[model samples]
Target chain A: MLDVEGLAKATGAGGKEKIKIQRQITLPWVEAVRISVRNVTIRLGRTMITASGIVLGIAFLSSVWTSGVIQDGLQQARFEQERELVAATTRDQAKPDGGKTEDSAAVPGEEKQAQNSKRIWLVVMSLLVCGVGITNAMLMSVTERFREIGTMKCLGALDSFIVRLFLIEAIALGVLGSVLGTLLGHLAMLGIFALRERSLSVAAKMDWGQMLTYLLLCILIGTVLSLVSAIAPAVRAARMRPAVALQTEI
Target chain B: MAKIECPECGEQIETTGIVTVCPKCGADLREVMEAVGHERDERMKTIVRDDSVTTHEFIVRTRDLKKIYVMGEIEVPALRDVDLDVRRGEYLSIMGPSGSGKSTLFNMIGGLDKPTAGRCFIEEVDMAQLDAFELAWLRCRKIGYIFQTFNLIPVMTAMENITLPMIFAGMSTDEMMDRGRELLDMVGLGDRLDHKPYELSGGQQQRVAVARALANSPAIVLADEPTGNLDLHTGKEIIDLLKELNQASGVTVISATHDLKMIDVSDRVVHIRDGEIERIEHRADIDLEVGGMGEE
Candidate 1:
């Protein structure tokens, strides 16, 4: 290998005397991700424990989402069936059924609005709990690895590199939890609807495209939430003094 | 507000803000305050990257370095005006009693802490001039550290641990693995590459640590009590390995230890007591009657 100082001097003005290039902390993005993935695998049990918080929150969100789709489909199907039945019997029966149908439809519509608000509140509360959970787990992860953090600092890791490693781990957890929750929530909702309504055809009438969109949106939520929760722990880990590693938990 | 009796001209002075001059004698306190790292000027932000700011020849040098810890109204001074220089490619061991500032001096030379009033230079670059990031940049390429605790990342295999520093040096994955293999083989841990820290014995873990330290082929290696936790035989092995590396590669090795055994391998042995250097002797001249002298 050529001498860096010599190369630096060659690049200097008049090709002599000055030597000016300094090393940069050039940690590649892909390598950071790979390290994080391997770290997650090594601590899979802990990873699962941390991710479970995300799973519980996302499950509530997706279940509520699935319920909304099922209700809309069921209500539309019932409305059409009743209107047709009434039309068939209208020639012989009294016309009072017209007003009754209007009353029934209006009342349920108001009830659904109230229910939606309650579901929104629950979703918010669960998400807040998960944020706390992820933050707590990540903080534990940082503190327990003091010696390891110290070693890396001694080996010349930039603070940004330390922060990057933790964020990657937290995000991976978020993603794993969210994808699983989405599947579980959708399946559970479909099972309940199938048992109660005995109309798989209504489930079929549901808009599949919208469900796909919701799944994507949930994943995005999970990733962002993980990133936010992880920031504090990552910074704390990076700011740890290398000297502390020498005196601690040996 | 703080009040002080000026040492010069016997003048009593009261001040509310930063005071740099005594009223009676016009004695400049600027140098004093700057030594304490209290200057409110551009000097506070300037990071000297060029090596010429400090004198050269010695790989590591310290000038009147001091560190004081303040707790409430009490001040405990750790190191008091330590002046030392270590030559290139020499094996040096610093021996001192507990609370004698051996570790403090070690850390200062390693560029791991700030001094209350002093400066340290590594390869002629002022340690006081670099910020945390730039200090890390220098540490990665210049000095490798071995800890008493054998601080290998617990989750990583030996090979992964050894290659970690290489990752920061911008080496490609292939280059890292090749270098990692060579280093591990050099350390006599080639067969244990896949073993994690927990799986390896104490000596093996320390060997991995040694490999990791040399990952980037640093110019100096700083070992803080390398044999503090090992049994006699294992400790002897580690000491021998360090001596071998010092001889074979010409990398300077500085160890802070009470282990008198370290003296056998060191080219120079420095004895420090009560925050000052007591004496320095070459390997041929050190009086061998003394055992290990300090607790870190």
Candidate 2:
């Protein structure tokens, strides 16, 4: 019922009516919103620092993938150019261009081999980064909320409830990270495609289905990683006797 | 059906099909029609319309309640057959050393944890009989809890934290805001409604927490070491605010604390040690100056 300005006025006046006037001052919703915004900004800053490692890891993995794709395209183009020159030479030399011809088949095979190797290396690096990123993020989140997690369970929040909360947070982080990584990855890929004179078609665009599937997979991985990370910690937290939890120093 | 509860009053209703009215206090009811439609004698259908007074008025009661846990091979009894009664408008303190079951007792009383055995009755309603939903509803409306660490949602502002109970209860936006402001005023945090927990000092944060706890105007407030994080001066101020709220609004308060200064102001102090009630003493008798207590 009391307004904040009225409260300020009363405080400034410093009279016997200060108590009555202080009681009459009410904080406006705008002020509540402003405070919430400031708090959210701070929370976001903490979250961002924690999530930065994951984001950087994802960005690196995605860039490696993009480069691998570019390498594959370039190698294929070179292989095609080499095959065309070889075909011209064979024709001029009166040699038959047979599928069984060693020279003709060998060029394509070598190109395919190069592409396969590049893809394999990219996949392995990406997986490693993802695994590390997930593990790190989950560990940090669990450690940060160790007391809170314990308090929640002591307050009768079930294991499932705690798991859901962690998973929800993981999913939120995954979605945001995935989107940012994908966007930046797309732009990087687009730069290559432009250099090759390839028109930007919707097909060449980032496969959103792939993006969504990967995001969901990231969410699942992040959740599983969080649950795995939190399992020992959550149990530790849950088993913390209420007496001990209450006595815990922050 | 497990008839663990009363159909009319939500008590563990005893006695079946003999209801002329509530037997505890006879009040008129639209008489339940018998399945057989058997004609009753005129004397059997007596309805005393004047006896509307409720008989069971104790807000909380525990009778020989016990909670035992096994840690590996040893049996750890957190609470051992503790009997307690908390009446409306009475401020009581549960005081103890480190291993006392004060926190456990508060948790069970608020229905945040289940008792291992025996009965806990709140508002004459036995907690052992209610389902999860019923228990949640009871906690929603009947009890408010303040933890030692100022358990305001760290992500939220003071106002949002204060309104959390009503938010859980599905109150309308305007109604929740109004009630939140009222609570903020009651706890004397009207000016800092927009501040976050980190923005406020320890005492101010505790005040915000107190406002949040009283958001729904629950009949009982259970605080566990609310001053553990505060300085002596701030702690005293916080205790004074709690006392003022209890005095002004007739809300029953049960605080578990080691601060003897807090005990100095409480109406009664229930001392516990080794998971057992040592004694229940009125504040008028004990000087509370015998021990020098340190802040947690």
Candidate 3:
């Protein structure tokens, strides 16, 4: 009922009479999603360029996780070998000649702990680099779309809409980049295992549930990092006055 | 059905045709119409003003509106005590040189900026009192803006650009497309609906901008230098198109421009200088043959 005709009637009354009409238009979630997706598609090159950092970060994370699984498998194999050696020594001692038992002990736990700490350091470094890349990319995107943002504001887009728009775009990039990184990490782990053990069966011996959880965690981190980076830019864009925004040259 | 309120007497009266007298006060409402230079038509039916009531007769009213921008330690004054009234179904132009605050005033009336020292009322609703959401609703339903740069989203097609506002207004996809197509046809871009901004000529893009501005059927269409970027011929075409739409739809238009041709189509032209209103020229009082006088 709050159409053009109604607006005309209300204004034509010279602002004296109050027309009790509901005029708020709630933007649908589907439309928001559609717009965000279309926006990402239109600027595919830029989006990819921005997402590359996230991809690398997640890939590094995946590598670390995969390495942890391989280390665990290697440890189990070493433990089994040590157990067999100990069993052989016991059998020798049970012999009638009573042969002198030689010590057959597993590798020290300190070495394994050192290797794990190094992997953790690498993962942490990769995450820091990824955060910086995402932040830079989001800031650039906000700057580039200054005019578009102004136009939307002029067309009555709410501040919340602007915020959601950026967030959705970031989320889309996060999901894609995380998936790519996870795949790359899996491939990297396979290569490492192949080189170390000369067999692909090491991957098979790893816990599948834990691997999946690690990938999921990487994806979650990518998304959260993207969202965090986008917040400042989104808020800055929403706070702009349409008059000043319109004056922007580009 | 036609509805008209009596100016002399505060009474809401419903009539099938133009009513000459107020049934309650016997005051000649026709004489009041003549006093305000309003023609007896469907467009003028609701423009009843009472001198005693002091309610605004204009759709947009400003009282001592001022805007001062503070940058760092310096205070820059953009608008200084601008009092303006835009009547229903009227085309008004604000003319000034660059940096004379015409655009500032336009922004204030369009609900795009807030005044520092005064009040702006759109349809008698105080704009300064509205929250961000309410202001957005006002801008969405009450105002449409046509920019000098033709501010179309480069990635979106003409049809998409036109329907953007409707989408914000929560219109369904079918409804948006229907209205968008109609507007495209109205603006003579029916075949160019699928063209992006880069594919279209400047004039064509401006026409699309015009169509998009009318998508929501806003009460007031504020155009800031609509012809500023077009060539002379294209500018004239755009002006003619705007004039046609104005006459055909009876929608109120407020434009800020330096173009003499644009001012020629206005019912009244307000001359502004140094953030203040210098003079107002009515259509009849304007001398079109004088060529250019105050244009920079």
Candidate 4:
């Protein structure tokens, strides 16, 4: 860390007092974010296209989970009805077989469990594909903006700042797209189940709190997936040499 | 330019070079010319202060600078042992054909690239000694760059482009706006600040780039073929604008260019060829003026 005055003096400059030098200076974080926000908005078409991958991934994932919840609610409703009828018809017969209370909460057979796992596996594969899509989109974005990144670097933007710009973009898009996808998926699942069952009784049986938790989880997964996928492209953009900006110019 | 006078008759004589005898008075003038004519001023003196170069001495000094790129075990020497000195307020031009390493040397001087061997001192600070952040700091305040392609951010308005560097310098919004306006006005784009780069023509965009370069009042400006893409008339206009800016602010300008019109405004032109300094020509020694070279 050679101070400007010390450096000038050591180098024998007679005009040492004319300039001041500091070792580190960076664009304030708020300013960097502001610039990034404006950049995303200015290129909203590409942003939306990139974000659609996250939206679709989270949509499919939440749809499957929500459909399972709705099916469980419907099954529990039917089970309760059958148990009530059995108890009423045989009130005094060995205290209604003495085991229905414990059996009411028991999970379904292994066949259902196996089916559930298969559905979950399909959703997970789709999300992985979505992650790859986001990565490819981000890589394209980085290459397209190579000249801009170079200009920014030459204007004193640090490599970290460059990485920060991409991450901020990912977060904003991920959060928004994921939230929309979750709501859309849950409602679509609910609507289809309602049409098939021709009844609103399943809605009453559902624990809204549990459904909300899964929705939030799906949203979180979508956002995290985007960020993870963005890291490689963001790092690549940051590691770019500023000279490439000039050399790549048309 | 000393006018020698005959001591006996007090008659003035044109005694440049070896005019030993006065034409009118028939008296020897060698003694008088020797006393006043042979004195060297700061510009002409070859003064070396120890082994170090100071800013007041030369704003940019490179010693035995070298850069070699390795492309899968193939060693490509871009620049080799290039010793160059740029004076304060001097307009220096670097000329070489494609693949001649002229741009490589320019990048090294601008601190945009590092030399593999030896040192490049800018404002008396060795470029290799500065960390990335500090090197950026130096570039922000000390070196301004104008590209041949006029690399203004496409998304930003001309005003924003000018203020971009000021933002990195940590100037307040108000100060940035004030200085941005002043710089845009200096480049004759005061009325076009709101226009984006795409909205303007090639020359206009380059003008905005010039304003952006000057936003920080940097001590040196590095222009790489600034007028290479413009028409002959527009290119000359750009050159004149740079020359005027150079004369007005006394900012050292070093350009890598093939445009001969650039030579008209340059104080010195450095010719690089095959990773070495082929020759250096001062403005005084260049016979070509504006249009073409030689036999004129």
Give me the iRMSD of candidate 4, please: 5.0
Of models 1 and 2, which has the larger DockQ?
Answer: 1
Question: Could you give candidate 2's per-residue lDDT for residues B224-283 as a string of tens digits?
Answer: 888888998778877876775676566778898999888767877999988889998865
lDDT of 4 by residue, B1-296 (tens): 23567877899774333467878878777777666443422211221111123345478888789999888999999998998888887889999998899889888988777788988888766777767787778777778899888989987899998888888888999988887876676555778879989999998898888878877777788999999889987787688767766765577899999899998789889999998999988776775454322221
* Candidate 4: regions farther than 4 A off: A1-20, A91-112, A198-205, A245-250, B1-55, B287-296
Record all residue pairs in model 1 with backbone atoms less than 3 Å apart, i.e. clashing: none
Q: Write the per-residue lDDT of candidate 2 for residues A78-173, one digit (tens) a residue.
A: 666777887787789897767645665686778788877877787677667766775677676666665665444333344444455554555555
**DockQ values of all predictions:** 0.22, 0.05, 0.25, 0.22
* Fnat by candidate, in order: 0.54, 0.03, 0.58, 0.52
Give every prediction's interface RMSD. Answer: 7.3, 17.4, 6.7, 5.0
Ordered from best to worst TM-score, the candidate numbers read 3, 4, 1, 2
Candidate 4 has which clashing residue pairs, if any?
Answer: none
List residue ranges in candidate 3 displaced over 4 A.
A1-23, A85-108, A196-199, B1-56, B287-296
Which candidate has the highest DockQ of all?
3
**How well does candidate 2 match the true structure in TM-score terms?**
0.67
Q: Candidate 1, residues A204-228: lDDT per residue as tens digits?
A: 8677788778778777787788788
Alpha-carbon TM-score of each model against the true structure: 0.79, 0.67, 0.81, 0.80
Superposition TM-score, candidate 3 onto the true structure:
0.81
Residue-by-residue lDDT tens digits, candidate 4, A133-172: 6677667777788888888778777788788888887777
